[model samples]
Target: MAQDDKAARGPSVAEGAALVDLLLQMADDDLVLGHRHSEWLGVAPDIEEDVAFSSIAQDEVGHAALYYELASQLGAGDADRLAFDRPVGERRSAAFVELENGDWARTAMRHFLYDAFEEVRLDACTRSGWQPLQRAATKVRREEFYHRLHSRTQLHHLAKAGGEAFARLEHALADLWPYVASLFDLGPHAAELRATGVLPADAAALRSAWEAVVVPELSELGFGVPACGGTDATSAAHRGAHHPALAELLTTMRAVLDVDAAAASW
Candidate 1:
């Protein structure tokens, strides 16, 4: 088939599955991390942050909905079901998002790192040959711009606070760095996704893009940046085998539906 014709008809069955995998990876990460962010709604250190985190949580979940809708249109199933009803083993979320939100410093660090990762991922998606994904990514990237700004500003402030605040953030970065690789793991369909132009870049390219942004900023802030060896066992676990926290999180996320499984919609 000619290139334009192939693009017009969209991906083949195998490529569609790869696209679904990519979409789920994007959706699951946002949904899980958004839930984690929402946990701070009532208990954030201050009123301003309570509002900020709450808003960010909403944005993340909204982005997830966008991706899930796209995936559903491609025959993945109902968007709501895909978000809330999947078994833990079937989820494609990276471990970085599944970890509990630690202290304020840790949360801030994770927020900064994840936003950096998302920025790169969305940038790549904007160039995808799949028009739906390209448009969806462009839309999501607009909101994410502010998210990255907020997280970056918050990190700078925390880093400048010195003493205990500095120490806590440093420790958080060290602990979180290893899991950063998981965020870039594109799962089993990575090659197909890239070959078909569903994603313009592979996992390594995405990770490199993330590192280019994150490393320099952290170093400038005088924080010790940890080395990331990509695709380690820990990163591999995030591809299919998730941490126990994901199951607990899914339970909470599906609480309403769980009570009435026969309900038509959420």
Candidate 2:
């Protein structure tokens, strides 16, 4: 049987910290990117898209909250503290989530790319040896299908437009490949995570799989993706390293939570 086959089965002491780290990797990305997507709430180009992005934002934030709660159960910290109090350098989210969603092109393509990577990560998490994390990931995976469909549909529309829309999407897609490269990194606890069955794929394997899905799709849309290479391609950024934008983003996300001074409710 799997180590975490039973609902009450727990990670051993040797693997507990690794499990929490993995949870943070997943949770931090969701929380930060959720906030990023929320920035488009009232400002999206079209009203219909605005509502769709809003719903996605809510799902991502809710997923983050569940992971944080799971981490709390593991003695990491309370959900709010874990979300609001961590320094940018301490966060495990990728540079992709932290980058500015500058325009409709940037925003739409970024959303598509992120949704693609997230689909892979969440699928892996659903198979985790840790039951609670598995359950949380499995539950969240249902909501992600809609997000993927929405992003994929938008990309198809923009790419087929064959004029300014195609040009813009091509540019945005190229810009995103570097950041997405880091999405699957296993970080310091990589060995422990795989050894314990907490996660299944490594950074390289996951990136390759993501590319196999995305590159062809973008090419089919007439976007020419350059062969990915260098540090950006390899994704040296993970936990403990961060883009400056992350600090700015965290400041905005923490604004309200910092003011309340430990209140029980918002």
**In order, what lDDT does every prediction score?**
0.88, 0.81
Provide TM-scores for the models.
0.95, 0.92
Best by lDDT: 1
Q: List all candidate RMSDs to the true structure.
A: 1.7, 2.1
Q: Best TM-score goes to which candidate?
A: 1
Return the clash pairs for model 1, or none: none
* Residues 1-266, model 2: lDDT tens digits: 75636345676676778888888888898998899889998999989988978999999999999998998998898988899889876898878787888789998898898888888888788878778878888889989999999999988987888999888877887777666656756788987787777886667767777788888998888888877542353443455556678899888877887788777778
Q: After best superposition, candidate 1 residue 208: deviation in angstroms?
A: 1.2
List of clashing residue pairs for candidate 2 = none
Per-residue lDDT of model 1, residues 140-231, tens digit only: 99999899999999999999999999999999988777677778889888888888877989887887788889889999999878765555
TM-score of 2: 0.92
